[model samples]
Target: MKRLLLLALMLAPVPLAAQDMASAPGGTLRFLDKVTGRVQDLSLSRGQSVALGRLTVQLDECRFPRDNPAADAQAHVTVVDTTATRPMFTGWMLASSPALSAMDHPRYDIWVLSCDSGFVAPEVTEPEEDPDAPLEEINEG
Candidate 1:
């Protein structure tokens, strides 16, 4: 009887965790720009990637219906600089373009994820290292 009770409890449906849900691209398409040059950006669903010139592209602002917003939006996209003899900083590390702003306002909260793997599509949002609010104090006293 104890075993059966445990099994029943285990079988009970657990409440689903709140995930950042967004829409995925239905198909793939080539991303392009006149001044920047050809881009290999492909959208398997209905999301968009922001390209900062030809050097870098931030694959964020995924508009897929089923995706984790926090994860998807915060993907890192680092584009290497081709012609820097001694570059101090990495090329286009976080090219956040805020693509959602261009799309319909209602879907701003949506996140894009890979239709196959279900991972966040690309760079959409990132962690804020330095916030405007003051940090909590820890006095030695």
Candidate 2:
């Protein structure tokens, strides 16, 4: 009877606050190349993949709170290596706490940086020609 009660309790569903969280439109991931001791940042859309050293990191999805984007960002990714038949890491990784769900590779480390939803690239406008400045001499000679 005690074992049955324990089993029932273990099977009970745990409630989560995930419904309150909003999904990010896109995200950026940071990776550390253990061999070169260099850190690199990679930007990727959902389902996009980038090469990191000998491994390929693919961003699956990203999510964050609509009201507090910086507070926490979560990303689902899959890291594959050419040398290995199986993927090194494939799961959700949190930006605030990367160690919580980190890549288990020896040569590379990856973590989530931020979610870029509604991000607008800054516009570049050529400076207005100085109307008062003298024009350069023509070099037709």
Candidate 3:
């Protein structure tokens, strides 16, 4: 009877708590050329693809914790080798734990950096004063 009870408990499903995540418009990724020992960082938006050496990387989506955007960023990415018919890698890669779902390429290594929350401000440029136009004089009080 004790063995049966223990078996039942072991077979029971454990409840898991779900974390709240926010999807960002884009994310940054790092790539390394293993042969040359060169590393490069690539920033890509969702559905955008970039070519590096013989591989092309495409970011499908990026997600981060709602409370902390910098913590635990995960991105769905697909990597294709131009010379090959099949994709070399396609899956979600966690920024904190890259080995959890790392690409299996011998010549290259790729990993997620962070999700871009669209917080970067655009550059504001003031219009140049017309060279030929008359300037308005301000009256000093």
Q: Candidate 1, overall lDDT?
A: 0.37
> Clashing residue pairs in candidate 2, if any?
none
lDDT per model vs. reference:
0.37, 0.85, 0.94
Q: Per-residue lDDT of 25-137 in model 1, one digit per residue for the tens?
A: 33232344444454454454323434333233334323323533333332222222344343212221111343532222221122222332355446778777777788899
lDDT of 2 at 7: 100
**lDDT winner, 1 or 2:** 2
Cα error, residue 118 of model 2, in Å, equals: 1.6
Best by TM-score: 3
Q: TM-scores of the models, in the given order? A: 0.24, 0.69, 0.77
Candidate 1: how many backbone clashes? 21
Best by lDDT: 3
Please list all clashing residue pairs in model 3, or write none if there are none: none
